[model samples]
Each structure stands twice: as C-alpha cells, then as structure tokens.
Target: MIRHLVLFKLNDGVRRDDPRVVEGVAAFRALGDLIPELRFWECEWNISDRPVAYDFAINSAVEDTDALKRYLEHPAHTAGVALWREFATWVIADYPF
Candidate 1:
C-alpha cells in the first residue's frame, strides 16, 4: 500500500475558522467517499503551536502508485487542491510499507 501524507500551512492571516478554510476542510473530509481509489482517508486540524507544526494534515492510503495517481487526479481532489491554493501551501510524501 502507499501511504500518502500531506502537511498544510495556511497563508498568513488566514484563520482556520475563516469561511474559505472551513469549506476547504470539508472538501477534503468528503474525498474518501467520492473517490474509490482512496482506501483510507483522514484529515485534521493541527492543535500544536510548535514552530514546525503545520495548520492541518491529511493521512491517506491507496493500493499502489496507480491508485494513488487516480486519487490525486480525481475531480473532487483537484477541486480541493484548487480551493486550498487560495489560502494555503502544502508538502507531501508518499511511501510504501
């Protein structure tokens, strides 16, 4: 399986409660149901205030690289990314285990 992890940092001045951020969170939360390639999905707001902490995170899994690609290309996923582009930047890693 491929574990797909992402850390997201909200743009400066963008609060988690902001309407856009709230909607973005919901968008990601709904992705698992929308995409069959997503074998697992979990997203959450960060609670830590550590300097290295990001504002949110996404932890997901897929059968393999191909399924991962499908998940990444899904329209719902792309739309979520587009919405996030307006208020955040993210970093990701995918590894097999």
Candidate 2:
C-alpha cells in the first residue's frame, strides 16, 4: 500500500473559519467516499498553534502507485486542490508499506 501524507499551511491573513477554507476542508474531507481508489483517508485541521505546525493535514492510503494516481486525478480531488490553492501552500510525501 502507498501512504500519502500532506501538510497544509494557510496563507498569511487566512483564518480557519473563512468560508473558502471551510469549503475546501469539506471538499477534501469528502474525497474518501467519492473516490474508489482510496483505501483509507483522514483529513483534519490542526489544533496546535506552534510556529512550525501546518494548518491542516491529510493522511491517506491506496493500493499502489496506480491507485494513488487515480485518486489524485479524480475531479473531486482536483477541485479540492484548486480551492486550496487560493488560500494555502502544502507539502506531500508518499511511501510504500
């Protein structure tokens, strides 16, 4: 399986309660149910206020690289990324287990 992880940092002046952020969060949260290639999904807002902490995170799993590609290319996932791009920057990593 491939474990895909992401960390998101909201742009300066962007608040967690902002409407756009709320929608983006919901959109990403729904992907697990919308995409068949996803074997697992976990998306959440960060509670920590530390300077090094990201504002949000995604932890997901898929069968393999092919499935991971399908998940990334899905319309819902693309839409979520587009929405997030407006207010945040992120980093990601994928590894096999």
Q: Pick the candidate with the highest lDDT.
A: 2
Local distance difference test, per candidate?
0.95, 0.97
Question: lDDT tens digits, residues 1-97, model 1?
Answer: 9999999999999999999999999999999899999888999998999999999999999999999998989999999999999999999999997
TM-score of 1: 0.98
Q: Could you tell me how far off, in angstroms, the CA of residue 59 lies in candidate 2 after the best superposition?
A: 0.3
Give Cα distance to truth, residue 41, candidate 2, Å: 0.5
Give the local distance difference test score of model 1. Answer: 0.95
Model 2, 19-83: lDDT tens digits are 99999999999998999999999999889999899999999999999999999999999999999
Per-residue error (Å), model 2, residue 48: 1.2
What does the lDDT read for residue 16 in candidate 1? 93
Off by over 4 Å in 1: none
Candidate 2 steric clashes:
0
TM-score of each: 0.98, 0.98
- RMSD of each predicted structure: 0.6, 0.5
